[model samples]
Target: MNDLGFTDEEIERYARHITLPQVGGIGQRKLINSKVLVIGAGGLGSPLLLYLAAAGVGTIGIIDDDKVELSNLQRQIIHTNDNIKIHKTDSAKKAILDINPNVNVITYKERFSFKNAEDIVSKFDIVADGSDNFGTRFLANDVCYLKNKTLVSAAILRFEGQISSYSAHKGSNCCYRCLWPEPPPKGLIASCGEAGVFGALAGSIGSIQAIEVLKEILGIGHSLNNYLVIFDTLSSEMRKVKINKDNNCKLCGSKPTITSITNHKDYR
Candidate 1:
């Protein structure tokens, strides 16, 4: 092993990354020492977890209170026929380990909610939010902002998907709440299940999420903190829209109302 502590096998495994000027030895090491938490193990989470582990993220935490259903197999590539009826977190962990045995996979067979938001979120350097519900998404944004962690969030419905990174805790960056002040009325937005998502759309968007997470870890290239990316599979088009921080936002505004998880809990 060299001074960076990369084994010969690791060097060989990540030779492509090491050869890149932007992500050389140091960047690969950064990736090998990073901790990332994925908030779901379904469509988006499936590909996101696989890419992260393959890229050598040191520790990965997966929290999902879901069972691997036959329907999930259509989009959740990380699971197989045998995984159906088992906990999604367990199935995902097995997949991650299969991809990279060196990765430390931590599985939480539970939902992401206010009760354990901070406790779980604070443990990771960054969070990838692939949750399908508004409650969990909002909670992740709030907790990530409160804990001063970078959050890369993505969602897919029908033939479209949207992704953005939130770092409002950092300079001039906007939090998720700035984009949608609060969760829409329960029945207003139909979920992927209800609306029927394009199976391949999840992989397309999830791969981008994985790229953003790596960029954040390596501190290389531009960050998506103030920009939102929307992808339309039907037209094969992708658009990046600029978003500005809202001063009146409850979470990250100057007169912020959400300073802690407790504040978020009370407001919710």
Candidate 2:
């Protein structure tokens, strides 16, 4: 129950968005009533939370089990120096509330797993995957497919990033599993902690993820349905490769076989 629903204050607050042909008063109202769930409140989650809150997404759920450490400050912009040691979900809730009191923040200070993924993701109109690991990504994708929820996903490593959207509701499109049929062997991939990622690089990709979520919610723009946009900040290269839905894709293919989230041995 928002008192300022479409008021001059709201119009002024989102004047830029309202002016756009794609998003008028109706679309602004849609945004005010939309619910988005964001997984992980770390580097990629930083900008996604900020921009989505500032854009007036009605309800935003943030899930993260980790606490803010001094090491995370270099990239996790949502947590302040004074907020160190606090749970990331708590820190993100405060930041979102500060950006726009109109947004309702739900904080889950726990990791997203197969057990809780469906329940949490089912509550939102869309889910943004900012997770740093492949296990969580696969889990989120499968859960979203089951729940028929739009999944706006992004991943960043070093100076490169990739963003895409997946939903059976939108019809045939490759899902996370379609891209990587199986998780890389253990120790095959290095995390930002080990490989190190540019702080701004995560921001760039996370912001794009937020935009994709907004577009899906507002039903505006050509959603990234079957394409993956890859960005290389160092070389200043941006590429959008069309992704064909795999006929044998275990997740979203025509004769799909993956019906549940199974703990893959390699993911461990």
Candidate 3:
């Protein structure tokens, strides 16, 4: 164990990262000290949590009110058949600890909503949004923006996925609301359950989300802020589109209308 307090086991475990010029012992230590909050424990959260734990992220917080369902096994690899019917937060915490017992796992057996957003998000350095609904996505972006937390958010539906990081608090970067002013009309966009997501697609996108989160913690590589990445498995193509902050955007615009996070009255 050196002055950094890395046990011999930890040194060996993160040798690959410590050897990298971009992420030597310093970067590994940064990962060890950083805290991240994940907004779901389902498909995207499954791989995202696992990878974050394996990469030696010291503190992880998981929030999800739902229980593991049999259908979740198709993409939510963090849970086994034994975990079915268990709260997703509980199941994901178990999986994270199993991968890296040194990690501090905080489980919130509740949804990430306006009532709890500020209190919960304020505790973490970064947030990863893997939620499946537009409401949750929008709420997370808003709360993270208002709180000045970096948000790494991703979504998967059918064979397509989209991901971006938002740090609108920086003033120059665009928030999710900049790209999407509002949630689409009801019945306009189908849910993953309704549309049938490709199970492997979750792995692909979730892995990338994990990468972006790690990069943010280590302050390495290009940030996805002000940009959105769209992956199409069917076409085997990936597109990185620049997202400019909209002056008319209600949330992050010049004249911001949404100065606070509210329950989705408009979303309804």
Best-first order by lDDT? 3, 1, 2
Instruction: List the candidates' TM-scores in order.
Output: 0.97, 0.95, 0.97
Clashes of each: 0, 0, 0
lDDT of 2 by residue, 128-228 (tens): 99999988888888888888888998999999999999885566666877877878876788988899999999889999999999999898879998889
Give the best candidate by lDDT.
Answer: 3
Off by over 4 Å in 3: 266-268
Model 1, 136-213: lDDT tens digits are: 888999989989999999999999999999999999899999999998877888988889989999999999999999
Full-model lDDT, candidate 3: 0.93
lDDT of each: 0.92, 0.87, 0.93
The per-residue C-alpha lDDT of model 3 at residue 142 equals 89
RMSD of each: 1.4, 2.1, 1.1
Q: TM-score of model 2 relative to the true fold?
A: 0.95
lDDT for model 2, please: 0.87
